[model samples]
Target: MNMLDYIDWRGDLTFEQDGFNEVDNLVFSELAYTDMRDIVPEDGSRALTVAQVYGEYKAAGIDQSLMMNDPLPVLEKAAQSPRFKDITVKWYVDKIDTEQHLQFAAVTFIISDKLAYVAFRGTDNTIVGWREDFNISFLSETPGQTEAVAYVNRIAKLTDCKLIVGGHSKGGNFAVYACAFCDKDISEKRVIKIYTNDGPGFMNEVAESENYLSILSKTIKISPDSSPVGLFFLSKAERKVIKSDSKGFMQHNPYKWHVLGAEFESADARTDPFINMTISSWLNTMTDSNKKILVDYIFDSLEASGVTSFNELADNKWNSFNSIFKALTKIDPNDKTDIASSIKKLIASGKDVVISEKQKNAEIKKAEKNKVDNEKQE
Candidate 1:
């Protein structure tokens, strides 16, 4: 039986399938918990419950039977296998079906996709702020991106058809990286287009390479109108701007991508304002040597801190400067220069650093109150 049949074939596991082929509802009968469905839940509060899985199926309305039955066990089997298994960056590969050529690579199965989906969990190997005592390391490399690049290359070597390279968030960035860095034959043969769906822009090290430039024409970056990811890594490359119904988290959802007649409203989106400002602030605020030192310190601190996932380390609140500082410190903690101190000094340099809508409103209100008071006195 297929993974789908194995997981949901029981009498109690009944659910109506939507016209979109998405599950409208999932009922877990007693007979549905087969051996193939067994999976060790992730530690802490990050674990996915059975009901949650069903809920995701209902919400996404996408096929996930193969992923559900095969992913976790396949990962377990692959790890225990003596061949093609390594503990580095926690690698696992599973086949969708023995008869089919489909496969999946996972980073602990936090999210599962029905089709080809790749994503990078940012801050995978870096600690930030108060997560030190939570038994999570903020230092370590996510070898998955490198492996994915290699995988794409291997797939290209086997096929000559146009390959649709795509990913969301960090995975989207990696898709671009792999397309750029892969062998020339692969680049020429099958890599027709790359869809970076709200992915982080490349780091400074790889931004200007010729390989990256080669695929610029084929690279299409799609992001929400006001994107948080774009605010970190700025790029002037190909951009497709989208509008989201909800702000922040809602914008990140693919479903929110505006679909017009034959195209979305992605023609005008460009680099993020925040990224430009940060890079500019860094350059204008400090000397070249200090910039070098600070950037290096941040990279090294993050590398040394070693975190496995962002869910373990991220704070409930969002502060741009603090977020960047945490990322840098996790990369290189040994650099003695204090990131917060430097940022504070830079902010004190008579710069317009604050972008506050509320503050602006308050100023307008105060001005109106003073005008009324002056009229009364007159």
Candidate 2:
């Protein structure tokens, strides 16, 4: 069973009776993608119940199915369910800035007077959103992450209620960042738990910082056992690996994640992190300047192709491919040459990293064998 099914089974119980579980964390995290612009107040002066929000959503012709991997059907059911129907949502913020290379959205679910969940929306259909995700490797803080800290601090300031920060994917990265860097009063006092549901990790610099370490005890990182996104830039910290109904990367979808009653179905462990580690090591090999050039070139190629949303790649595949191929003619020759050179260097760097890792592993294995042989002889 997944989140939608879990709602069918357990949606009747109130937070008072059941308390906020990881399942609840994900439900709210997923719903943060809902475009609440005018229906949900940005000022937090007023709020609307999930049912009422659904009505407004319908009236406004808001179709969330346009967004990538978004689950609007779940929201429809959530509106009808007893547990989530009356939950108030407020302080919705969605920002997309091409100049800043940003895509960020968040909404606060006021569960009760004493408790609230601040859920950040993850990567959407926007190219800018994906660009910000890539920026995570080279930049200390992506624009979305910076905004997240401010949003969390602002929400935490407005109420005395304890806050639970959560997000799926890029939003998960934001949730961790906001909780880690929020005001001392809010981080140490108001924020109770932070959940990053299959969210990618940060650069080693940010991951190793004191601010991030301070909230380690309060952080809950959960991922599908076969996760492709969450495993990227792999953080060595413990994560609760959950079983998924889908195979491979598609399991990144929260709805496909299996739920066993109130909790996710557990896996023995995550799938091997070898591929993820190699990608991380490859990125680490590049200087920040080189990383920026590659990041910009990739996104620039998408923009040159006139692709605005990722949905276009799926909905109109042949046309999108044709456009992408045609876009190469429009690129400046110098930029193309630069990108090609970067790729050549990347191939060389990747080979060295893999060879070094294999040799290190072989040494460890040889040492272990020698120790075992000596012990057996004795």
Q: Write down the TM-score of every candidate.
A: 0.46, 0.84
Report the C-alpha lDDT of model 2 over 23-71, residue by residue, as the tens digit.
Answer: 9999999889888887887898778999999898889988665565555
**C-alpha lDDT (0 to 100) for residue 92 of candidate 1:** 23
Please write out the lDDT profile of model 1 over residues 281-337, one tens digit for every residue: 553345435555654454334334443222222321134334545655453454445
Which candidate achieves the best lDDT against the true structure? 2
lDDT of 1 at 83: 22
TM-score of 1: 0.46
